[model samples]
Target: MLTSANLLLWAVLQLALLILLQEAFAWWIIAIYALLLLYSATAVLQKRSAASLKLANIVAALLTLALLLNMRQAGVLHFMLQILLLSAILRLFAMRHRHEARQLVWVQYFLIASCFILHQDMLLALVIMLLFGANCYSHYKLFAPAGARLNFTLTGRAVLIILPLWLGMFLLFPRLPPFWQIPNAKIASTGLSDSLDPGSIEQLVQDDRLAFRAEFSGTLPERQQLYWRSYLYEHFDGRTWQVHPQRRQQAVAPPTTAADVATASYRIIAEANQQRNLFALGMPYSSSQGVKIGSGGLIVADKVVSQRFSYSIESALAPLPLQSEREREMNLQLAAGNPKTSEFAAALRQQHNDTEQFIAALAAFFNQQDFYYSLTPPPLGRDSIDQFLFQTRSGFCGHYASATAVLLRHAGIPARVVGGYLGGDWHPQQGYLAVRQREAHAWVEYYSQGHWQHFDPTAAVAPERILQSLDMSLSDDERDMLIPFWQRSSVLQLLSLQLMHLDYYWSVWVLGFDDRSQQDLWRTLRQHIRLIAYSAVAIVLLLLAGMGLWLLHRRRLSKPLPAKQLLLKALKPALKNKAPAQSVSACLNELAKRYPNHAAMLQQLVQYYELAVYAGQPQAEHSLKRLLQQHKSSLAALNRAIKNT
Candidate 1:
């Protein structure tokens, strides 16, 4: 009996932590918790005295309080969470009464809510269903009469009855925006940023967590043609790249490339990343009301993407023809540093006559050089491009892109770095592209011949990374990454993909169900809205009536037997010479005399029956079962004696 309670509580805590602790708790804290949990389990199994547990609980409480108060590494919220978890552990070990056990039930609800708050994924939703079932059973066992088994059959029937009501309420509830601004809970920022520091792009590659998923409407573009332009960066301050300051002011309809628009309009389901940076294939033509398209044909949100967001996007496959005086000047602007980088650009300009030829020659230069594409590049000095070009000659996409933009500007050409995701693993089986943070890439877009064309210098060095997924584009050394690294299991990769496909649709239909979708649904059912509403109201009324009837039926079935009925059944066997319903003491004497060998058991049963029937002991369920068991044995002895006579 205690085993079920212990396992259920522990399982709830473990599952909650599995979801919450992904971006929260430290390793040492988890290790310490594991040890304490082991000890608590041992104490319960050993059946330690209550007094011993009280002393241990006091020490544990003091230690936990001291740890939280003195710990500077964790925030107040995290500390509160830690304290709550510790108290739960302590309470689990020291459960002594029905009151304390009831307290644990409320705590389980809190843990479930905490997990939901942290993870809004479809997988969590499915797991929550199982958790609900377990909780129902645990609750039944906790408060049920001692020695009585939980009736799962009744529980299942109750769930089946309630499920329809739950579904009705969910469908009928108005989809309203949040009443209060939800806090950006403890997850770190992920993927691309407007500003690019020395190792900013490098940090993104280390985390291969899903950034967003794309599902297209038509045929997909070629690998090289799939240039996902997030937003344009127009300013460079010697080392770092910043977004064009007047970008918001320059919000205008971007020029179309040639006459051909993108046939492959896609919908992107982006994960929340504590930032407003949203992504698409190229230029986003269609989006939700909350989103805005920048002048450079990139998506921008009014608020931080605090949850999973879905937006439709239409992008042209060809190069975007950006033609404007402001864009030309902004993209061409260069910082007053890196004299050697300027000199090299001047030499390249002197070699080529035409602007297009100079760009092509420059693109060729990266391939002709000894530059190496690497994840682990050496640190740079003051002039980053000068060092990368002359000495180190090794860096990722950000390095090559940044250096080329600076070099292009020095040569009197308009160029800027375009930051966004590149290639995604096209899961043919699922028909959705899984784009991870490792696909976070930066490349140069130089304006020439009245058009802005995309050029990835990283492609000249590491073409495979542009052509294939991150995992397939890695060296043996990068493939074996384990410490603070991302990995995909080759054995279960296909299985994982199929599971994610299911989860994605589930999230879209369930978690991503919003006001717009509700309105669309409402439009379809407008003619029958009154009929549906009436039917729903009628169903709810019927359900309430049914539940009231069930309660009354259960009461009738399990109601305790009255004193007269109970006494008559107990005394019937020994009443051969007496009245049909003999008094308790008279029935007891006859039974004890007939079964003298079983006198002790008969006396115990008689005392319990008197306490329950005459004294009216409310908590007599356990005593009743014991009395009935002993009474059956005494009746057996009487029968055996009668047979012998």
Candidate 2:
């Protein structure tokens, strides 16, 4: 009942199915899974044979068909995983023959690989190796005689012998990129969007979800200087700000900046936000494949970032060139229907002729007024800009940036809203910065003095929000949930970060090591390979030398064997020349009759010979040798009689 075939079949089926259990499944499907597991346990523990299994087998096939037809809601990979899971479980009930058991081993190999594909946790990967050893032992037991003890030494030797060949192939194989993109399942994430609306960004900032992590080429920048812009909002209705169609349709050209300013290099690992807008410091230009700088100096990913994505960029961190009249006209667009805010802005402009002076005047007004930077701001009527500027005077970065851009546009200053993160929590040990969603912000960029200049009216109202983390600006109530565990306990903080470091290397070397990473790795590996390249070439010579020793050992073991003389001496009287042959026991009986005093000794020698030679028990050979010594005198007499005859 405890057959190795059944053990392996159930083991692979159970482990592989556990991996897929993390996927979204119907409640009824989970019930069926538990039922199948129960059925397998019954067969193993109770030694019960499969009954009415043909009907169950038919039901399994029908279920597979049903899954194929109803998997429109699931991804292709998810569907395939489910189908394999069902079939793996089904095989547990049917491993009754050698052919079927052999097929099950092949299925187990795929199951192990599938587990690695779906997950890369350190503990789980370690578990797979342990399971692999068990599978190898199962293979030995499946073919060995019944009740044979498990032989781990055989499996261990086989793995060691194949290790060198496996390493050589892996290091020398050519890497090729995938032809099609694997569809990523959707992820719930927090980041900037293509458009900005009243309260959209303010509500987003309340979430403490991590956005991205950045590492710089040199010393980290000051908190005030970290402006990671991702989106530029131009067209604004009374309540919402959106991207002008013309903005998205702009010619795919690099953003031009003055060559005089120094540029800094930094790389970022961004979490999947289901948005194509890329975040970077200053105006970024990328040499990474499939990424390009679009209009308004915004970096754009080739597709929705559905996983942790990485890219490198160099930023000038200076004034960007702005010359297109079309861009000027687009940025100046506003809902003329909101006339009250426009009239108020015109009066503020009357006091200053210079654009810089007018911008300063507006900043002075927000500072002088009783404006409160509140997370929970009151909703406005149709004339949102008018209400927010004159009446409410209290909202998040969105309310401040929107009103500032509206006022600047009404004053004949072309301005647009820039959306991105502001600052991040610095990790000195890792030498990186982790930007969170709470750092989401909006500021105004105006085309002034032959270049677009950055301006933030909200910065004038609350400068601490720009100079430090959002927690510094938020009340204790607003920031309680955002507090990191590390801040509360020293031990937890140290342990969490240590685990993060392990995950970083695992992702970089394993999950993220695609064809492109391989090409880059090859360049570095080529130098080391140059040093050890001779080792592989020496394999043939070493094999020859080892084989010579093996042959010498073989000669010593089988030497001085004259087969005819040995056979005659060993088998002569005991295995007679009779027409009808007798077994060793029967031959011993005939010999015992001739020498009655030695009958017990003769029969004992016969039994020993049967165990050592016929039954293939090497452990019994010692007893056989002693019995042969004791029977030498009797056998000599019988041999002389046979010789005379």
Candidate 3:
């Protein structure tokens, strides 16, 4: 019976944790839990007899196998969860002993430990509290009588007392890293990617998913200028752009000039995306811990970040003149086969004297011509740049930037596609800028004079996109508006920003504090060794004192009698000792002869005491006091009376 009860409890715990975590195997666990409930009901119908319960138990085990099959896609941790759940269900249905029950109890604990891997949110912590309380209640009920109506109340108090101790242990416990790495369940990837494909930023625009968080050391850049750079794509395949692996370059030292060093400084707290690209401002010169400088003056991770990561960077947004011939050549290289664009560029070069004049002329034409910024564009065929530039002047940032970069390259000017966010919404509460996926944009960076000069040709056609972002540039009826006005209203926007801050803390201080954090924590602890030692001694002393008090209180409460009742008990032994002879008649006769003055009182009291004693209600108080007062004479009389009788 105990075994069955324990198993039932264990199964319930597993079901609860699974539901709370919202694991991928939710349906399987639900089905198994239902099966167990059905089997339990059937056993109850058979009056809980062991032999009749076998069929129900067997069916439950089979359902467990079904559960495993259902959770095949959930990976190993989920598989273990299924196995343990099924074992608990089987144990409960076939339970016949206490040992099995104890095993089930440990199984429940193991299930809880598994929850730490699945989720570590605050809500899960509350659920664990309830499970722990239930465990204690079950143990209490095993020994407590059914009539003890205060059992729940007492159990609640015990749980309250136990909670702090358990928390203390939890907090002080040395958390070990996972024994072996478990296969990670796929979560959403955030931030930018190396390849820019269709539908890449489609769903991401609708996502409120956080990409990364930043904390500035000084004044922050305006939302319109919060262009966090990740990667630069130089290869274009007409419809999509890609970063070539072979062409990947490292960062070079910027020219040391007064104006060239102008930049903003800040720190970033980036979330894990299992990608190597790290976002910084315009041009970063230095980076914080764990970040590596890449060939393109970008920060690359030593490994794919699988946890929340933080880094600081120094960036310069100031313009610098192009100097290196190799850098310029690399930027200008485009796949050599578009005759129309090559011819158009040659014609434009004939009209302009220099590279600077060519760039200015192109920007002037885009501004004065029938160019219009539209999200939807007509399909471009083989000569995409030629079609976009000469015919369909109506295009989004992608079209404008791609055409501009190709034109500059054809004109013998070094240019590449710069991929990053164009603008952001400033969040007051978070003190940071929020750049969503829709803010994703591309522009041209061409080597001009002596350094790379950022040139946004889209600015000529859609100036508002550069000033307020694509989101704010579009009105309610506009096709390019990602968020409705009501959603982006200041009130709603403030609430979202606050939520982001909370998410930031949860990602950093809570969820992100892992093995490396533990090492830092231990280092800090070692520095304050005296404080830790004192706290340890104080806790031990407090525990010892509390135990002593509890023991004393228990010893006192176990006995019901008071001091008065104890005095009556003491008098019985004294009175029995005073009897001179074993014979009752002789003791009485001797008492009458030797102490005649007290004989009447003695006889009357003894008779009354005997009657009351036989009736099981001794008039203990008055009789006990009278016997004490006459003890000396009565004893002498009783000695003589014993011999005479």
Candidate 4:
């Protein structure tokens, strides 16, 4: 049985190895791992009984839980792996014999496997593959072949086969769609929501989650014009607003009048917000596949999307509503307790003959007054509109939109709130758009001149706020998380962006591959099966050829130079052909007395050969042959001299 102190020492060694594996530069992750390893090792070294080990394990588990809490936003796979690492550390403390030590190693394997779920990059995958080899070697060393002589070659071959098989299983196994929703390990939202309150916009500024991505087919929409409308909030609760409650499906009116209906089609690939709202650009005419567009013009997924989901929609900038009296009545309804605003609307209606002029006056009121667009808006009292307009002039998109809509009602104009993201990051290389949560905005649409007219009141206050990103407008303190110029230009960041594009495409084509994408894949495969098959075969052959070449290199490492090169004694040869001369130095010394000039040349040639071959420099093939031929005469003369002597 291993003594407690020795076991503790072993635990510390294993943990240091693990810390090195994590590549965590964070002193805390390293320090915590080191401290725990030391404590566990010390407990074992002290010969603490099983009870003490168990108690130590319990404390380790608690510490793991605490660390896990810190990584709550890291996702389920990350949290589990961290806990497994802690469990391994705890196991290290308890290891009394070889069996327990092996179990601790298995825990390490589990931790390593979980890393794939967090980072699936090619480099990380390769590192994990190597770690797998290391694991196999450790296992072989510990548990030799039973009753059979173990050889390095056979053991290595077994490991090579096993590792690929394991990787194949991981990649090929169909992960059954989760029957139940896994609790979002991240406490924060991944994308913008349909709902908007006072603090909604402010909170988004702190999050760095990707909201939606757009790949344009033709000329991209200008940043100023790219108002990708998502949700429509018709009903308000004096404080916050929500999309008019799930309404019953009704038949939509088909298009009648056709005028300037140029369609701007887009395929949106969005990460799930766990909300029902499936976002699309304004005036969506037609949609493809899984989405069911409601009569109220709200596009929703047939099922709640928990993973990345993709859908295509065609939108037109052309006007949608053509004078619906029923829709106008719905838009005009005022909330129950706004008597003062209602009275003001009656007076304004009687005073103004022109509705357009009255609307213009209200817009000018917002523009001319000291109203400001701010992410962090002050608390609004019970009379939300009054507090916003009179007391707290600083507000977000919601405040501007809400106050505008309420003012429109007071001026006897039918209006409602439109919620959506404003702009997207234009990737010049990938030619795609990435929309973030911080792009979430709210605007107003009034029923004017027989149609719903989009009017942005935020533009009235801060015109740039409607067009440009808030990051551009924020103070240095607010822009803390904004990627710095140097950081953005870094090689790593560029590489990361490229990888994200690849991942986005992977998600679009593979992860989010629904019935539609499957059909598309099937069609393509059917069209080019023979060519595809031949290409695949060629790729496999090339890979095999490379593998064979690598194996040959590994084997040839210990071999002697060609015999022809060995004969070259005087002429300076290519560096690759020169063999080690320390043992042969004595042989050269005897020849030096008879042919001292040739001895110096032979030594120089040998040195050059050693430097080229052993020092890892490239060797030219023809140069070696030329070297052998040039020294042929000198070598023969030397041989004759030796024989005669």
RMSD of each: 12.6, 9.3, 9.4, 11.5
- Residue 132, model 1, lDDT: 57
Cα lDDT listed for each candidate: 0.73, 0.73, 0.66, 0.66
Candidate 1 colliding pairs: none
**Candidate 1 stretches greater than 4 Å from native:** 1-42, 49-95, 197-203, 244-260, 316-328, 449-451, 467-490, 527-645
lDDT by residue (tens digit), candidate 4, 478-522: 566555455556797778678778877676655665555556666
Model 4 TM:
0.62
Q: Write the per-residue lDDT of candidate 3 for residues 1-645, one digit (tens) a residue.
A: 343454456546655755754554566466756666566646645557433357746776686667667554666666677676666656666656666666766676676666666554445555787887676556554555654544567668987999999866544567876588766554335667777643344344545455666767677776545766777777766657788665565345553335645578776766567687877776677776688666556678776775667777877765545445666676767775667878878899999968788888889989999997765567777777777778876677767777888888888887887776666655556666555566667777888667777788977887887876675445455532556666667899777656666766666666656566667877998999999999999999999999999999999887633323333343333335554545443444455566677677556655645444444455653564566565756555544554564
The TM-score values for the models, in the order shown, are 0.70, 0.70, 0.64, 0.62
- Compose the digit string of candidate 1's lDDT tens values, residues 32-79: 666666666666566663335666578587868766664565555456
Q: What ranking emerges by lDDT with the best candidate at the front?
A: 2, 1, 4, 3
Pairs clashing within candidate 2 = none
Count clashing residue pairs per candidate: 0, 0, 10, 8
For candidate 2, the TM-score is 0.70
Q: Which stretches of candidate 2 lie over 4 Å from their true place?
A: 2-77, 86-172, 179-190, 206-209, 336-340, 378-382, 484-487, 511-517, 524-645
Stretch of 10 with least lDDT, candidate 1: 482-491
Ranking by TM-score: 1, 2, 3, 4
